[model samples]
Target chain A: MAEFVQLLVSGLATGAIYALAAMGFTLLWQTSQTINFAQGEFVMLPAFIMLSAIKLFGLPLYAAFGVSLLVSALLLGFGFKRLLVDPMIRHGVLPLVIATIALGIFLKEGVKLVYGAEALPFPEALPQGIWRFASVSVTVNDIGVLLLVFAMVLALQGFLSRTTTGRAMQAVAQNPDTARILGIDVPRMITYTFLVNAALVSVAALLITPVYLAKFDNGESIGLIAFIAAIVGGFNQIRGALVGGLLIGVIDNLSGAYISAAYREAFPLLLLIAVILFRPQGLLGRAEERRV
Target chain B: MTRWLLPAAVLAVLIALPHGLKSYGIYLLSLWAVYAMAAMGLNLTLGYAGQVSLAQAAFLGIGAYVSALLTVNGVSFWLALPLAGLVCFAVGILLGFPALRVQHHYLAFVTLGFNALVFLVLRNEEWLTGGTYGVEGIPRPSLLGLPTQSPIGFYYLSLGFLVVLSFALYALLRSPWGRAFAALRENPTRAESLGVDIRAYTLLAFAIGSGVGGLAGAFYAPLVEFIDPTPFDLGTSLALLLMVVVGGSGYFAGPFLGAALVMLLPEWLRFSESLYLLLYALLVMVLMATCPSGLLGLWAQARERLSRRRPPPPVLETRT
Candidate 1:
């Protein structure tokens, strides 16, 4: 029972990170109907930025985190999106998707080329200490991750529901042609989606990297897993994404303990394939009527 | 005369090109041929059949492992190669089942997940696969009394296989099956209305495409004389897709050119490993932009320019 509780806590912590990463993808999908393969690279680059701010610029931890998120949101969310995505969007879906994949490779190698090939250790941001009670123990890192994720989710929910821009964004996602007919600036909404999504992805990276250590390769697998999480949870809904993340986290932890550890990574993929095959609409997603 | 001229011209180049190049160049040429075969498979799926497969590398790995395991166990390379293709064909059909059910883009996840799963199994199933150390000392098949250990011998052998595969693909594409695949790509709903079973044709495309990939992998195993999981990852899968796209996806002769450009361009830019990838990615973007219709489109553009400067000629309505 103690072990199970500990596993559950850790699992939720990791799932929170996945939920954050997946939000970037689902957010973009929600508005623009564009899926960025570069989301992983978004997380990867920001983690490096934060590390460099601490290592090279000698900024304090909180300041570095803030600086990294700002730079990533501006550079990737605004600049790269305008330069690559805006042009490719006109070309059609294949080119846009391929370009994003290319951007991922470019950013990965760009980090390796400029920052050197070393995987840098992230500076500690969360408090270090264990909280134990009656054979059940949770680390401060776990608590910090959970609280930060919850806060971000609530903030996003409030922003999406309460703000004019957020509602407009949802309107665009619901029906782009209709939204445009109603005089909404659909492209700007799409760009805003990218910005918020980038912020959330970076935040996810900032929280998760200290535990796993930041590496160029970290982005690929984590990005893929988060993508699956979004898929299983229903990429259309925020709550579904969270549930998907938590489910994946629990499954990952339980499978690692019970099933063969060597194939733990395979479990998420199997679940993903099964979900895609059996439930393309996802667990929480409602099926749309198809044209005859 | 035109048909004979083109074939004669290509044949002359193929025969003369290997003899003029060094051993390493010949080896690279062989690798290019292998990649061309695989890219053609991808073309049939993504280009013609309109399926998005991110697991091309998985099929390639399956072929490599099957052939490598069989050959290392004293089975003839000739027998193992076909067996590899057959195994991959079955696997492709199996993957196609899920593809039939899911949306095309969502189906990419199925392939991606399958890719990751296959990689794990390849790396972990240590008892049969030889694990991370990889299977080595794969026997190169010989014809008659000649051994393919020599670079020249292997190059010709690979080229022969490529030629056979190309002609076979050419024949297949010219058949009604090819028309069905094209119809599926152009309009799935319309094709379905015309009594074409979308499910079966998509399955056929995946099976044939992946079988070709497996064929290339079988050749790749012997060419490299080693098999490991590293080369058959998402990166290589993307590279294969790049080759097909760059070469000109719908063109029959496109994969050959694309494979050559994709595989050989890096060798020419061997100044820095990282620079090569950056350059290649940039080139793909440029090629994709300049010739949204591909390299053939670029050629057509050049022809248009040349024709414009000359006397007015008959014009064809250009299709987007």
Candidate 2:
């Protein structure tokens, strides 16, 4: 039971990061009808930027993180949507998909060229050490990540429900044509969606890099996990993405522990396949009406 | 006049080009042909049928491993090749069932998962696949008492298969089935309304495309004289997709040019060493942004401007 508790805590921490990434992914999908294949690389690149801000520019950790997030928000968020997605998206989803895949390769190769291919150690942000209770131990980092992500989710929920822009973004997601007819700026809302997504993923990158370490290729696995989590949780629901992420995190950890560790990566994918086969809309997703 | 002249000139070049080249050059050409075949298969599914699959590499890997395991154990390469294709066809059909339920992003996700699953199997099944050690020493097949052990000989063999497969695909594309695929891609609901069996065609699109990929994989195993999980990973799948997209997906000869560009451009750009991939990716991105229809699309546009005549139907449309 203690071991299970320990695994559960760690898994939730990992799941929190996945949840953050999934929310970003779902946000983009809902607003733009885009499936950003470069999402993993997007999340991965910000961590490297943060690292460089600290090491090369000699900035303090907090300042470096702020710079990194801002850069990512401006360049990856705005720059990506404007340059890559907007132009190709009008042609078809396939072109956009292919472009994003290329973007992923570009980001990965660019990072490799600039940052070097090695995994760099990330500075710990959370207070170090573990807390033991009733023969169960949990790291403060895990606790800190969970708390941060939970707060962020709540904040995002409040913003979406309460704010004019956030509600406009939600309106754009529901029906872009209808939203535009109602005087909402659909394109601007989409841009804001990308911006919010970039910020959320930036936070995920900061939180995750401490545990996973900053690696050039971390995006591939993390991206896949995020996609799975979003799909499992329900692509349309923000809360579903969170729940799905936590579920995947727990399942991945438990399976890695109780099942064969050799196939840890494959297990989540199998679950994804199962979810896709049986529940195409996802666990929390409603069945979409087929339109001609 | 231009049609006959173009193909004849191209054929003459293909035949004459290998003799002047060294062994490594011949190998690269053979690799191009092999990859072109796989890309062609991917084009049929993604470009023609409008189905997005990232599992072509998984099918290719399946074909390679199946053929390699059989041939290394004394089965004829001839028999092993078709058997490999058959296996992929069956698997593709099974995967197609899930595809029936999902569309666009969900379908791509499913296929991506399928690719990962296949990679895990290839990596972990060490007793069968030799794991990361890879299966090596795959002997080239004999063609009617002719030993294709030499690089030139294998190049000709690969070229021959490329020709045969191209002819077969051309015939298939001219048939009624091809029209169905085109219709399905253009608008599936409309096609279904017109009494086209979208479900069967969807499965066939996957099965035939994957079968061709498997056939290409059969060649790939002997061409490399080895098998491993590395080349069969998601990278190769993406690369194959790149070939189709870069060449002009719906165009019949798209994969041929795409495979060449994707395979050879890096070698030509080797002067940049590590920066070659970055350059290549940048080029692809620029092309996608400016003209998502690819090289053929640009060519078509150029032709349209010069002739000022009714142009062929474009690959790009507003159809979602």
Q: Pick the candidate with the highest TM-score.
A: 2
- Candidate 1, residues B1-320: lDDT per residue as tens digits? 68668756876697779888898888888888788888888878777776677788888898989988898889988898999899999999888887666555765677778888888988999898877989999888888878999888888888888889988988898899888876766667788999999878877888889998898889888888998888888777877877776666666777788888878888877787777777766766666555555675466567878788754321111111
- The iRMS of the candidates, in order, is 4.6, 2.1
Cα miss at A274, model 2 (Å)?
0.5
- Look at candidate 2 and tell me the lDDT of residue B93: 87
TM-score of 2: 0.97
Summarize candidate 2's per-residue lDDT along B1-320 as a digit string, tens digits.
87678767887899899999999999999999899999999888877877778999999999999899899999999999999999999998888877665655565778889999999989998998999999999988999999999999999999999989998998998899898878887787899999998778876887899999999999999999988899999889988988998898888888999999999989988999999888888888888887788788788888888888765655454232
Clashes of each: 0, 0
Best prediction by DockQ = 2
Each model's C-alpha lDDT?
Answer: 0.81, 0.88
Docking class of 1: acceptable
CA-based DockQ, model 2:
0.68
Off by over 4 Å in 2: A289-292, B1-4, B315-320
